[model samples]
Target: MSKIVARGAGVVSGMIGGAIAGAVFKQVWKLVAGTDEAPQATSDEYGWGEVLVAAAVQGAIFGVVKAALDRSTSRSVHRAIGG
Candidate 1:
């Protein structure tokens, strides 16, 4: 039962984390690039450097958000299960 609960929590947390990460990335990109839109890989207007930088920043943000949320959820579930 605890495993089942943890699995469910993980799924929910993952979804929430993705949303938070995406929003944070958008804001960060706006500040860093002075634009609301991050360049897609195939965008002709942006050079390779610009596209790579945006991808790196976005990946970092998403990783941090996911790790944080996963850690928090695991701890909460552990405590709730009296472990």
Candidate 2:
């Protein structure tokens, strides 16, 4: 049960992080392009296809980061335990 909860929390954290990173990227791109206007969001502009692609990419990145953090924590705990 604890493992499941931890996994869920990790996923939620990843999603939030991804969204924030995406927003930052969008803003930076706009700034670099010298566009003062906000981009328009049309129903067909960003459909499920774009969303899924972005999610997949972000998910992979998040997964790798989470795995690395978990491994580092495990190693630290092991060292503290003199193992």
Best by lDDT: 1
Error of 2 at 26 (Å): 7.9
Worst 10 residues of 2 by lDDT: 35-44
The sequence of per-residue lDDT tens digits that candidate 2 reaches over residues 1-83 is 54555566556666666666566555654565455433333445556765565456545655665566556555655565545
After TM-score superposition, the amount by which residue 35's alpha carbon in candidate 2 deviates from its true location, in angstroms, is 11
TM-score, prediction 1:
0.96
* Per-model TM against the reference: 0.96, 0.47
Give per-residue CA lDDT, model 1, range 39-79, as digits (tens): 99998999999999999999999999999999999999999
Which residue runs does candidate 1 get wrong by more than 4 Å? none
| Candidate 2 clashing pairs, residues 3+ apart or interchain | none
Off by more than 4 A, model 2? 1-44
